[model samples]
Target chain A: MSFSHVAIIGLGLLGGSIGLAVRAELPGTKTTGYDADPDVRARARERGLADTVLDDPAEAVRGADLVILCVPVGAMGEAARAIEPGLSADTVISDVGSSKRSITDALVAALPNHQIIPAHPVAGTENSGPDAGFATLFHQRWCIVTPPAGADAEKVASLVDFWESLGALVETMDAEHHDLVLAVTSHIPHLIAYTIVGTASDLEDVTRSEVIKYSAGGFRDFTRIAASDPTMWRDVFLNNKDAVLEMLDRFLTDLALMREAIRAGDGEMMHDTFSRTRAIRRSIVALGQDDPRPDFGRADHE
Target chain B: MSFSHVAIIGLGLLGGSIGLAVRAELPGTKTTGYDADPDVRARARERGLADTVLDDPAEAVRGADLVILCVPVGAMGEAARAIEPGLSADTVISDVGSSKRSITDALVAALPNHQIIPAHPVAGTENSGPDAGFATLFHQRWCIVTPPAGADAEKVASLVDFWESLGALVETMDAEHHDLVLAVTSHIPHLIAYTIVGTASDLEDVTRSEVIKYSAGGFRDFTRIAASDPTMWRDVFLNNKDAVLEMLDRFLTDLALMREAIRAGDGEMMHDTFSRTRAIRRSIVALGQDDPRPDFGRADHE
Candidate 1:
């Protein structure tokens, strides 16, 4: 059973995109949107981000069959609590948070009686806000649905069907495993990007201008990742702390080995490491998970 | 004086791009190319990578007024020595090596009497080989020229003019400084990417399939960088050891601080670090060094 009425809390990139995607892909589905910030609600109304833009979260969720909270992970509990007054007994509660386990726990605690199934669309741009979202953001992207233990199979199927209708491939996993997987894939990459950009910015010998000017040499890619929404990433790292820290330590250990190889001039080891990675990239391109064109088919190169 | 005939010693991505760029942007400039591997030389000939693709490196450089060695950094000396017998007394020696100091020293030692000036074009896709190059690869990209101490100014100016003719913005600097700047901008970024890709691949808990499937979360960008030519990257690390290690240490230090912040749940610190990075991305976009479109304007999203 697909959701006919979807309510999105927090009208940022993810929320706005879901609204737009629903409008484009499932024209019959009604989307109601709300944000804590009044300015965002005003902007959401102007952009036609939903069928109805409400100032109050509870008002927005009223009459919705599915309520998807799109706020940062740290705010999931508060957002879940905000909509409790408006939630119907049959409405399925879910969130678009990077880390699923913590969000699942928070949502369960906040709405003890509601059906909670958290999911993360493994897609986004470096931009944020209502203006940064578009209909095709989820097209051909992976959306991992992390259901709590013994989650109602019907509700889980409904949520998966809803996402599939919006052009996302859905994968169901336990909340614990989802957090561990996304911790390596998303959280740690962001941490590394944020760190490198920070290091580049705080350099004493290399001027910031030089870093910016010669960025095409590879530094620009990190800048793009590092330019992601600060609040969202901050919360992702904080809430996904255990898994992120674990993945980060593994990455650091690998990096230390690389550093030693560099210091010792172990060219063969470096070459082998560099060469084996191309197969994974090839596989990703083959699977349509990434742009097959070189440099991601960036317009500047063309 | 503009180069009437330009000799490219390695017909790989950089070399082939130079040939094609010269053909497109400087129609009058003739290009002669050679690769040590017979297969690459044959492919370069078939692709019209240069006006003339020669079997012998010496034959390739004969009569050319400028010779650009585009081989891996470690092979620069051998490539320089190969063309020494055919180089005109007036031919200016340059290279497209990532590390300027090492390349400059190698070229000077190989052709002691010839004018050696190393320049690095901060441009490329995550691709290699003769077929991977295109005419506009250097358009609007920065070409940093690091001339040896007491190098003839006219030859340097001529080299700058040649690069400018190919639509590159040229900057002159000393070799040592160029190595330091590129360490942060290019070498270390590649190292981090290679290490992260390796780490993700070697993970026992997170299957390689999972890593590839969920790469769009952030890991795909690093995979692209890590998929870069292994031989070239290996040479970059070995040749620019001091500066790359220095920058890597700084990055590690910054990453440690971020790790601690995450462990301590310092949202403010993470937010502050993440926020400041956007400005650099903005500057890069403003300067047209990177694609301003979200996700580098990847076609997969559109």
Candidate 2:
């Protein structure tokens, strides 16, 4: 059955985007959302991010058939708990956390009576808050549904249909595997971007203004992501600690080998590694995951 | 006096772009080009990358008032030497190498009687070769001119005007300072991207297909840059070893601090660092170096 009433906890980018997308794509479904911060709640009301922007999570989830907690990964459990009082016993609970395993466990533990099928919509921009929500944020994006082992087939199908209506392609994977995949694809990339931007700013010899001016050379792409919602990313790195750390370790090892190759003037090795990575980009473009236009079709650059 | 004839050595992305840009923006200017690779020369000829695509660098430079060497950074000396036979003593010699210090030194040593001014058009796509070039590549990009001390003012001003005509903002700096600034902006960003892409592909737990499918998460941005011309990037690292290494060292140190913060659950540290970098992005967008559209204005993402 299609969801008639959907509740969203934590009305930030993902939460608010879901509300807006549902309003645009599934007009029959009513969206109720709550943010812990009053400023965000008022802004969400002004933007009509949801049909109803409630001040409390409990009030937001009342009478809802589906409740999606869209808070930072670390706060998933608390958000779920906050909605527990008003949530119906049969409500299917889900989330849009970057890392799935911990969130799934935390959610399942907090809402033992409800259907907790954690999902991560692998879509976003660097911007956040009520203003960042848009109807097309999930268009052509992937949303991985990491349903727990005993999830009901009908509920899973219904959730899939919900995301499909919002223009996201749906994939199913085990939560553990989801964490591992996203660790490489999302978490580590955010970390590296954050690290490099910090690195550029911290350099004493290179003026910060120079880094900003020449960022079009390559650094700007990283800054777009490094500027992402800090709290959300911080929670991602912390909650997905093992997977993110493991990926970071592998990245550091590979980087050290590259450093040695450069130091030894091993042009062939650097060239081979760089060449192999190019194919991955071609594959990403082929899969329609990225814009094939040069420099992502930036106007001035063209 | 304005240059009526311009010669380009190495008909790759940068060289062919200069030829095409001059043809489009300065229609009266005559362009001659050569590539050491006969296949690239033939392709350039087919594309009409220049008014004439000559077989030899010497022939290409004959009667040219300005000759710009656009070979790999490591090949700057050899490219300059090859054109020595036909290069006029009055012709201004310059190059489009990412690393300017070694290139300037090499060009000066190879053509002691000619004016050698090194330049780097801080613009490019990841793509390479004649097929990868277009006339508009340098529009609104920075073309840093790194002329050595005691360089002729008239020659530098003429070169600046030439670039300005083709739609690039020009800035003059010492070659050494240019190398250091680029080390922070471009070189280090590229090395980190290459390393992370390699690391992601090498993961034992995450499948490559999964990584490719979910690259929209942020890894896709790195792949675009990691997919850059390996030979050119290899040359850049080798030629600008000191500055690149210094920047790399600084990046690693900052990254180490970030890793520690993550490990210690220092959310405030990550939050502040990530927040500070947002200003840099704002400044870049304000300066019009990048398209301010979400997701770099990608069609699929839009």
Candidate 3:
């Protein structure tokens, strides 16, 4: 609430949603937005995604003390440099990228003068673009901040406070740890989803339609995950290849073991594996990350 | 409403939910239920899952015009045999088992006198037992009826009417076609989910905990599928082995191709695969299988 201005780069789901949350919860902090897509900027203006929409990133960040980049990992460096000239020396710059280390590295390289406090709000939808934002997107979600070592503690604290006001639980971890953790939690899982859905998409015409028709069983879940923004996910897998590959290796090895068990008709092994994963579902439900209540979205339910 | 009495055996989620749905939609049709587990039978009675609760399956089916067995596939034959002696000669019997061919064949062998219309209401949850049942579980879901080649057309039509009244779209396919269709739509997908989640569960403790902690990205979706009723799913894979194996073979072939692409760092291939699958998600969303608008359960901005 104390900050007079904030700059949001990219103006997509993350940026626009942050603008909405900041407006709803941060109060009177004039938000500015920048995106290469002129249509997104126009939509932002119509929807009041930000108080000011500008063509140049520098102009958007010119007077703001806080600048947030909410673009794909592949675009972070360019966005960072474009806004660097307008960012104040006291500005705390952050990003909502899936891979922490790559974006943090890029930010450090692109804007040396600004306080680069990398953040990843571990909450989002498969949808993208400015129109895909909402105020409650960050509520009860995890926000991981990987601050540059021994950097401005107060600036980092302020940014964390801002996220908290948006109802996110702030966590601070090193960039490598963040990437490794997300590899298991998000990256590898996303890759598998993309692959599985990809597998189904290649099915014969008749089978493919049947797959879509009766997908409610389980494949529907993978389809939702695979439908995420293609460019963002493509960059995530490429940028975090090592961590992704490591996690993928472990996953493949485990899958091989499962395949063997199934081949051998080892019901005990299958049952045990299923039972163990059920505990994970219980934990997630307990943590309230997933709604225990059933939701057949009216669009889908109808 | 015209049917004097209906009976459901095995009052788990399927039977109990069926009973509740019938009670809500089919006025004045007396229903009775039987469960092998007395505790479940008592819960079904207390919760008014049926108009009557009987310990003996035969006693429950004695006077009912319709006897629906909502039991595991492995037990369907035995259950059919147990209640056959008391079932009315004109009574139409059905079962809500996942695999139709195996159960239907068994029912024919066990209860030669009864007009068995093997049916499977293709809706479910990870939770089992009577307490997990609710009135709306089958609302707007599919119920596949694998009627025998020369079965009574009127009986089939009435059975279809019964499910339609309970808010299901009834699709009557032959047993073999139903098995093949379900192998692609349900069984193979479940196997992959179980395999992937099983793999994650076998990871090192640190990564394992991290997987559970941050499952919102994608893995949590698989967790729900993997957490399904293990015994029922196990029986499904076992009974529908040939069909499941064929689908699994195709899935593995596709997955291997993806693995090669990832290994070669072919961004174009990965992107192509992902982009194609997004269309399937769109179809599923369009077909009312899942929420297409900003997945991961984010409500509309409004």
Candidate 4:
């Protein structure tokens, strides 16, 4: 709690919110934020996202006790390279990037002797930038840490405690396992959403217009998923290509079977499949992953 | 708005909700409801979904000024045939089914002597049955009317007024066009969601478990979609096969292009498609089809 300073790299929602959460949740914690965009830096300072906002990563991290990277996955390497020059030997460096293996490698090479603990907080909205940050973005969400064996145990413990204080359920695993699990869980799903929405976008102008108009059905869901930060998702697919491609292969195989069922007018097959998927929703509700409101949008039902 | 007698057939969410909405919105309306299941009718009356509930659909339609058929699309014909005998010659008969083409056709044949105006309220949640009745589910949603040309204008006008009072934006079109529009809008989208969730459900145990656990990423959205009423969706596909197939053709072509792009590692194609889809989302927000909440999780964001 007495840490002299916590530096947040990239004044996007994740970084800005972490700064805000640390400020409010861990009062007396001195915070500084850095971003390549000077406008974002100014906004962060104006919004009191941090006690200090600076253009240079080194300026933000200099003499800081902890440095947290919260940039797009593709930017992690460059961010680490830029911050390495000023990172102290004992600074606990962590990240909220989606990919773990690639980021951990970049940080290790950038700051050879510094204590680095790669982490990913599985909480976010499609929105981006400093102004979108909130004080409780990570509340009740999961945060996974992929620390290499023999890494500084005290730093790992402190990082876990930090996320826990922000209402995150902290878990630890290796980089490869994290990538594989997330491939099925997140990457492939996002890609499919992007693919479907992209499909609808390519329709004739009239058809596309109607699609947007009547999107309240199911296409709107895909659009919401498709609207996620493209650069971040692009990097996710590229960085996690192996796991993504594997998951996609399985998905395609299953989708092919479903297409066949529909083509053959196999109601039994369709009904059974639809029914099985319903159980996962029940489990999701049980796990408190859903809104818990029975009729989410149709509150009149109550 | 004193409706002396209002009869709602089928006793599901739509039927029960019609009773609920009308009772609350149009005062002094004596509502009656009927379902094949005696227990459902008993509960409907007990819960005040209707002032009177009957097991026989014909009995419920007796002495009623309005008779609403609220059964699943596939069952509409049978319900129409069964209740035709009891429908008064001057009764304004309508339906709350999803697909309009088939329902309108069934009503034309089965209730030729009665005034039938097919209606579909474009609002509902995953939950169903009498217990799921709500007084305001139609608020701010659309209620599309597919009245046969030269049908009694007074009856249509009265129905429109009733729906408007229930908070629906009423629009009228031919049943064919309605089917086509909803095919692209709702039916095909539901089919795709069911297919994708089916695909996920077929994954190996490890991947399947991971899918449910990490569904928050994007797949969960599809699951919520796929979790919709299977009977209703199945009938929608069968009833609106032509339009659904047309939309499916377009979607499949688009998906094939995307599949090839991913297979060939066409990064530019992926990036361009993703960027294009984002505009549709902006349009949906502009149309107020979506709540501009950064995330579509039904949460009120500040």
Q: Cα RMSD to native, each candidate?
A: 0.9, 1.4, 2.4, 2.7
Note the residue pairs that clash in candidate 2: none
Error of 1 at A26 (Å): 1.1
lDDT of each: 0.91, 0.90, 0.81, 0.78
Which window of ten consecutive residues has the lowest lDDT sum in model 3 chain B? B293-302
Global local distance difference test of model 1: 0.91
- Give, for candidate 4 chain A, the lowest lDDT window spanning 10 residues: A293-302
Per-residue lDDT of candidate 4, residues A1-302 (tens digit): 33557999998889988988898798877888899988888888889888988878888899898899998887887898898888887898999988788888888887778888999887777778889888878776678899987798877888888889877778898998788777766777678778767766665533776677666666677777788777777778667767777777777677667566667777777677767777777777677555545434522333
lDDT of 1 by residue, A1-302 (tens): 78989999988899999999999999999999999999888899999989999988899999999999999989999988889999999899988889887888899999999888889999999999988889999988999998888788999999999889889998988877888888878788888898899999999889999999999999999998999999999989888889998999999889999999988989899999999988989999999988888899988777
In candidate 1, stretches whose alpha carbon ends up further than 4 angstroms from where it belongs are none
Tens-place lDDT per residue, model 3, A78-149, is 999888788778888888999988898898998877789999988887788988888888887788889879
**TM-score to native of every candidate shown:** 0.99, 0.97, 0.94, 0.92
**Predicted candidate 2 versus true structure: per-residue lDDT over A9-36, tens digit per residue:** 9888899999999999999999999999
Instruction: State the TM-score for model 2.
Output: 0.97
Candidates, ranked, DockQ:
1, 2, 3, 4
Tell me how far the alpha carbon of residue B295 in candidate 1 is from the true structure, in angstroms, after superposition. 0.7
Task: Please write out the lDDT profile of model 4 over residues B189-270, one tens digit for every residue.
Answer: 6777777676666666346655666666666677777777777777777677677777677766776776676667676777
Residue A263 alpha-carbon offset, candidate 3, angstroms:
2.4
